[model samples]
Target: MKPGIFKPLKLKPFRSLFGAQLFSDLGNWLDFIALQVIVAYHWGLDETAIASVIIVLGLPWVIIGPFASVFVDRLPKKAVMIVCLLLRIVFVGGLFYAPNLYILLLFVFLKGTVSALYDPARQSAIRMVVPDSMLPEAVTLSQLSVNTMKIAAPALGGGIIAVLGPKSPFLFEAAGFVVSIIFLLFLPSLTSFEESDNRMAETSTVKTSFWKEFSEGIKHIFHAPLLRISIILSSAAFFIIFLYDGLFIFIAKQIGFNEGNFGLLISAVGAGSVAGSLLLGQWTGWNRKPVHLMSSSAILSGTFIVAVGLGGLGFLNFPPLVWIIGACLLGLLGAGESVPYGYVLQSETPKQMMGRVSAAAMSLQTFSMLIAPAAGALLAKQLGASFVMIGAGLATTLLGSTMLMIIWKKSGSFQPIRGKQLDG
Candidate 1:
């Protein structure tokens, strides 16, 4: 973060929202690890089942979220967020009592649905209290909590699962939600904040049908060149990004690394992610270029992944610790993925359409993910994980570098006039 990053923290509503996100995201990562344990180790399920969990996580957002996000715009952002958090508490608790894989899938799906709505509303809420000039800093700070938790929660969740049992992590997840709710309770009405901004309909209402709102949002993104291009590049980046993501265990094994130590590799990725995010936030050159941040991220991340694959193939004589370092670099690049897209979505979209537009972008990313895991796993099985990583990495680099060139090819078209909010 930059020296003035703390400026956003001066606002009490933003402070409350930040605190809530910190706890909420921490518990999310903890639940992620705990579920892996319960599904793969405790239940002794097959690889298909484990992958199914990943797919289920994205299913709601991809399939139902874009349309459902219409309601997010129609409701009070704070109320929607609070309700979603409360529902998530119940959904996380449901994991403990789930009797079978099918039941477990249902609970995960429900939780994802709530998150789909909660996330966009949260984005809208941040835009509510934080000034546009400070929006980038606020978002970076919010995501810092997520990346920070990514490093700590995996280790902590693993320890809790081993010591207290697989179900113990859920208790912590619930605690996180409770704390978030406590903080959210302090978020004052932002009616004045909305008024000062001069964006119309600062109040939530239902003048149009759900289908109309949904179509308007989709049209808005498709109509705006920068938003359209940035979103497509971000989504496509993730599609390639995930090609080797779920196959890490196999990648580790093929590279002669122990599978049990996979958590360390993940933690390394988290640390790299935190570092990368902070570095970019402070990097004046790429300060608010969403496309550049994302494009450069894809190219660099691919190169690192390719190196890891080569190491796995005995083409490079790197030790396991070095491999972990490589994974960290990849994780650092992962930080670039969301932050840039988020900045664009918040800064470019109308305040009224923030919920729908963010959801649309997220849904596109999720749509790519819905198939990437299965594809990656199958590819790893057939061609060996190292070869799969190499292929995926090459593709990712090409996509990143190509998209950056195409967008910048046009000069004034990509630059935005900052004074007015995008009605689109």
Candidate 2:
């Protein structure tokens, strides 16, 4: 039997944690818009300067994520989360008084550093709170919350900025951290076997070096074939899909869409993401192999992306409504890949190494973000935005096909770890 969408919410700790994360996610999007306005409009920065700001914000995750996860594993996950949130609130609040672009960039980098700790700790904490059987639903619902915010927060931030001021969104974001901290305070303490058993073993026996512990995480990921394949495919998919973010404006213009209608494209993706997550949340078990499911979704998503490109090139000749529908279909298929991919990571990873594994996975995604925009922009300049989109779609389709073939040849079936097998 399938679980209800609300099934994970029935767990008290998960319920509170989910609520807190929802507020934080909303504040993040709000702050994202506000910062863009401050950097581009208020400060009169050019495109290069704005891109530099984004690079600074993302650099910490790529550089510091693995080391940060070591602390997450050593400390109590809840304690790390609360402290990280408090630090984030301070850095976000500092954004209000940032008198110059450099100062603002400094604060954004600090906030990103803190978030590095917060994210892995939160993922590890979720494992502690819910039974392994419920993780897929929990992850799906969590993704749903994020997508819902993605759909709404931009509009909310715009309204707040218009009514209040440019700095209002940062203030709002700071207040959200306070609320998130309050919720964290009500949660119980959580400790993994590594934290408890390993700590005692380290104290009484020989202590493991920090480098050794960190290296273990890297080794674990690469050594596990299934985990390794998923990470690579996920990173490739992210790189391909995010190319659109850099080229969307040009693509929209080619399709005869004004700036206002461009927003509709983003909204369509978010709406489809919500629907896809909701569907996955209720459909208890996915009886198919994880790799097959993931690759198939990628294929479908890439197909839609190709369709969107063809529409822009007048090959498809899609009307505005049809174009929007294609974008929604792209998003829907994207969720089909992403949600299951997340489940594969969480379920396959040992509880003790959850922080490290999650951090590593996140770093890969961040690295893709750090490069995708620039690559897309350069390609769009030479080949045109329509061709860039088509190229990305074709690349994604090729990647999925290759992975599907490899997985089928190496392992006829890949079963996700559940219950007791998960702990192994």
Candidate 3:
């Protein structure tokens, strides 16, 4: 690899890809914060309505995302990435001119659809460039960027919304997309177009049925004891853990903080997540102990979330200082779950098939994200947000422990210690 942009990364191609990924993700963060503010203030949307919009945005990935892997494999991966980026640039740009709620929702849906297609290509591209031994570190470092970006971007969005109008953030988001496109164009070629063309030509003739590839991906995951258990546990845990989306504002309301303080509250969780992600990145040897680490983290995270709900309800709760600790603990759980999962996916799967396998895992997370808002909103409305949050936390803790026990029985190992390598 040439030295400069490629120094920390083992491969030049991966360095370019990483740069593009970072800028694109930054745009996504800005869009999310800006749009939610529009809904809350301009449209006067209540919690349920806001949650409903989020559910709609998430639904397509669960419904249409599986097919992306098969299609991504057929196309030149870099070309596919560029195409998706262009599509997002066009679609998301619509928000700047209109900025109405209906138009905003449409743009949100378009962005989600674009992401569903784009994600598979990005996953496959990593395998194309990076050496296998470096995957864990790469995955960890990538997540560290994501967590760090998460910490700063939302606050920036909040500040922009406060200073300028709502549309200011959209303009910034558009600028980020443009920057990503420029980075992608500057990327040095990996496989020659001719080589990729020849590689496709020499592979076995295309199967007649499209779903055959999708079925194979699903079957491979189910056959792997660790992968299957991990997916199930993570999905269930996320469903419960994400109640914070609904609970954050409610708790803020309960504690008598104004709308601007909402940014600070979110920042607290982001701070904790950033710390956890950095710790995991620096300590790359924990890949084998994923099951044990995930279980313990989930248990602790859920316990803290339950405490937060109790604090809100004033049920034997301490002062606001204690609540901050609870928030940080919840963030730790978030980081632990995410970092290990990324390492497992990058390390365990064959490079060529990573797109499908990753899509399969992500499909579950998409559904979990979809269900979370609805479930959280309904429970918050009917019973009470506090009760719903407590219940969710308890449920997540139990689910993680159960999944760990089952996986341990099958593999004779519960922790994430390394063992066999799949044929790439």
What TM-score should be assigned to candidate 3?
A: 0.89
C-alpha RMSD for every candidate: 2.7, 2.2, 3.7
Badly placed stretches (over 4 Å) of model 3 are 1-10, 45-49, 192-209, 255-262, 413-423
Question: How well does candidate 2 score on lDDT at residue 166?
Answer: 89
Error of 3 at 134 (Å): 1.8
Residue runs of model 2 more than 4 Å from their true location after superposition: 1-3, 191-200, 203-208, 412-421
- Best-to-worst order by lDDT is 1, 2, 3
* TM-scores for candidates 1 onward, in order: 0.93, 0.95, 0.89
The best candidate in terms of TM-score? 2
lDDT of 1 by residue, 1-424 (tens): 3476566889999999999999999988998888888999889999889888988998999888898888887777888889999999999989988878999999999999999989998988887778777877787787788899988888789788889998899999999999999999999986564455433344354554666778989998987777888889888877876777877777777777785787788778889889877875665245457787788888998898888788778888877798888888888888787677667777788877888899999999998877887788788889988898899889889988897898778755777534554432
User: Which candidate, 1 or 3, would have the higher lDDT against the true structure?
Assistant: 1
